[model samples]
Target: MISPEERNRTGRGCLLGNWVEERATTSLDKTGPESDIHKKGHQGILTVDWSSKLEDTSTQKSAFTSSKGTSAQQKGFRYELMKEHLIKSISEQVHAELTAKPAAAELHSVTRRDYTAGGFQWVRPTPSTDRDYKTDQAITFWRENFDKIQGVTAVRNRDAPFKKNASFTCPITECLDPNPENDLDTEEK
Candidate 1:
């Protein structure tokens, strides 16, 4: 004997551990609005055909299940695309290098001396002695005229030489200067 206000508050009736609401037992009537069937349909009692919903869900599940195949195909396509791009870039670089002129620093010719048994052995070339005859003659002329050059001779006694001067005598020697005035001036002040 619940009041309408109490029924509205609880939204439905509960009796003996079972739902006693009339809406809970009523089957969905197809003649009703399509939106009412979806909103108010009771579980196991709804007259609405669920096979269509099941079909839609199965199609979605199938799409999800086949994702592995699609992903593999996508990966293979991406790999081939990347490989083609790399090859094209490499070929372009090689073509550019081939068409470009060699730099001045890289254009020099390298003389490689191969030390292999059958290869030509490189040796230091010696200049001919005939071309240097003037140098040798000059050296010989200097050697022959060395004794003729006027050079100072070494004296046996450094204190006495071949030519003696009055200035060369010791300060104490009276023969250095006979002038008594010059001798007195030569003494320490």
Candidate 2:
């Protein structure tokens, strides 16, 4: 049986995975509700544990800085901390995806900040923004390597009616046209 911590971790990982999937699937819908949902996700509160951990680290760094640490040392410390978290999260996420069975999950720290200027907060990105950013980045990456994703074609068909041509007529107008013969004997009394 998975422990509570493991469950929490996995739940977090699954949440991220689901978010990524949503972003990928809704990549083409710019004006859709998914984008709004994604924006909300980014602005939502940071996880409590991650926030506490960041606070503790910031306090330690501040104490160390005040105690004989030079400016360069402070800069180095911040850089290392940010790098460590990024590296750690990326690696762990990959490992979890690979080794854990499809049923299993893990927590991923989507945000990271250094211990400086009131510290940084890890904010969970929304599916929409993540998708948008991913789409933009993917386009750039693919453009650089045109050979890849070149054959990938997407066809979008608009469901809403738009004026196709100047001669185009409105269905509503046709229905409401006041001609006794236009009813073709189908009009109800």
- Against the true structure, what is each candidate's TM-score? 0.16, 0.16
The candidate maximizing TM-score is 1
lDDT at residue 131 of model 2 (Cα atoms): 50
Candidate 2 C-alpha lDDT tens digits along 34-136: 4464665532145645445444566667666555555565457789999999999999999998897675555544442333445558698757544554324
User: Candidate 1 on 1-189: residue-level lDDT in tens?
Assistant: 445355335345455335445434434333456466568765455435666444356666766664345434555778999999999999999999989987677543444333344656779989855565543334455445544656534222222233334443546675434564654354524
* Alpha-carbon runs more than 4 Å astray in model 1: 1-75, 104-189
Would you list the C-alpha lDDT of every candidate in the order shown?
0.52, 0.50
149 in model 1: Cα distance from truth in Å?
37
Tell me how candidate 2 scores on lDDT: 0.50
Clashes of 1: 0
